[model samples]
Target: MNDYYGSVPLEEYEQILSNREYWDNISGEWEMCSKMEDKLVRLGTFVQRGGDLNRVIALYAGGREYTYRVTIQHCIERYLEALTNKRVDNLKLRLFKLEKEEAVKLLSEMLKVSIGVDFRYDKYTSRQVSFGVLDTRWLDAEGILTAIEQEHRQAHHDESVEEVRKRAHTWIGDSWW
Candidate 1:
């Protein structure tokens, strides 16, 4: 069952802690990608909000070799319109085409060297590739809620019910409700 944060089993608190450690490692790596994504998104926003495309292009010109990242960044920059019009994927394709073919080809090579992750896309299809970069390794809403529940269960098992309730109240001391 899922709660706001999700439930974890009482028996699995230790395992969950270990899992959290693993997730933390993945999250650390994702932090860098997320920052880059944010920067690109902001640049995209600037362009869409009456900023010069020439300047935008110039700012990113030298970085074209990182075509997929640049494309995703540009797409994020125009996120509202692209999302509203269901054109984000299309925009990605357009941006992909703008890249030198060799750079696109070299994407796999770059991924191998940098993150050890693979580029997963078929170039023949005109569909825009969703950048698989994720900031959080744990994105499943249900799973998260379940994990939270599990933690609560573990705490309940480990402590008396009154203690648990007291801790909760202490954490939210002076609550109106």
Candidate 2:
């Protein structure tokens, strides 16, 4: 076994990414590990630190074949790593299976929360006002906004399914614009 706190082999990471089931299982495992770490800390046991980007990537690639929690875990880990450059050392991750109605309700709530600001007409948008917080790929504000402006003009609509993308891009371009 490797002496590193968290080190995943490249081939293992690829295998996990390909196997969804395997991925999900490991996602659950990470979640459990995280929770256990929390408990340990509470009980004065040494806190089990979270995996770094390399570890997450390794796990993701490891279980690429199966449809499992690993996929979501990988995505969440990647998102956090990309955005914060820190491991998930002290966060709680959960997986919930919702009914159709519940899913719709959650979706509706998400839409409302994510698009609460109209970046097109607004002069100042808060960082919390857009989906860029969720996906760090939108860090290039100007580029993202340019793309949004083009898309909006093409669609000739104030809002579309691409609204969040536009807002994120716009915010990226000019936080105070």
Candidate 3:
């Protein structure tokens, strides 16, 4: 029912090109967020390795903390754009977005809690929250991967055979394998 050029249909090539363009438009922001996430991982590793708490606090105070939040927020906005443009109507996607927002809120709350503990006074007692605690809460790789898998499954279920074939062709054409 569909025409093919070599291993892929012309229609699929056009679709792939459109997808590439969409990704390219957001690639810069995505790369920036990825780099920031890498730095966050490194920071978490540093704290786990028993790095100096005072120096760590000083580094975070120098803008890393703000940058981390801003980067994450930017990433969330970009993800929302992708989901919206793709017309994704999956409950998992909604749950994933909600989880991300909750993580951000928790991070803010943890920081606020830490401030009171870091500068303890007779009337300002608060529970101490470690950097590792915040890092683990925010960087949930498994949960993200699961959400993505669920979204892809939902997307896949809606695809016609021709659509799936075209997607496979596009993938093979784009990848070395």
Candidate 4:
């Protein structure tokens, strides 16, 4: 009988060394999670796996090791394209890249799209209730018409400003890494 303490089998040791070497030798910066498929059931935006959507969202969302917070997240494709090469791990560098007047335009557009529109997609714009028991004659024509019209809308709606938000999440997938 023997007590073999702190002993690793040769095969396992070699595998451990191999993994360490591979990870340590990786070039530049890397992350455990990069391209990932996220199900956007609410927006119905299907993100395919192993591309860059995860990275893009991370950058846009900001404050990770790879990059600082972008601060401003709204913009046209052209402005965002400018940031394609702007990679830095500091908040200043990220902000510097987007402090142009055009960036202001980007911010404006982003805010405007989601605002001004009703937050609730109530499916029913109008609700009128008229009930009579003794009179037993519910005379309501407009209410019926409004309900019919509002049938198309949805309640508790979640959406994105397609042009600004979609590109920010999906199109900018390859950058800021």
The residue-by-residue lDDT of candidate 4 on 1-177, one tens digit each, is 011111444334333322211121132321242111111110011111112232333323343332222222322232222222232222222333331332333322322222121122334645432211111023232243234324312431343345334333432332332
RMSD of each candidate relative to the true structure: 22.6, 19.2, 21.0, 24.1
How many residue pairs clash per model?
Answer: 16, 32, 0, 0
Model 3: lDDT equals 0.33
TM-score of 1: 0.20
TM-score of 2: 0.20
39-156 in candidate 3: lDDT tens per residue? Answer: 3333233323333323333332343334332333333333332323332234233333333324333322323222211122234435433222222333434355456556656655
Give the winner by lDDT: 3
**lDDT of the structure predicted as candidate 2:** 0.31
Alpha-carbon local distance difference test for all models? 0.31, 0.31, 0.33, 0.26
lDDT of 1 by residue, 41-158 (tens): 3323332233433333333343334422234232222422322334434333332322222222222122222221124464687543433232222223234324444555565465
Q: Which regions of candidate 1 deviate over 4 angstroms?
A: 1-31, 35-41, 48-50, 63-82, 85-177
Q: Candidate 3, residue 131: CA error in Å?
A: 13
Clash-forming residue pairs, model 4: none
TM-scores of the models, in the order given: 0.20, 0.20, 0.20, 0.17
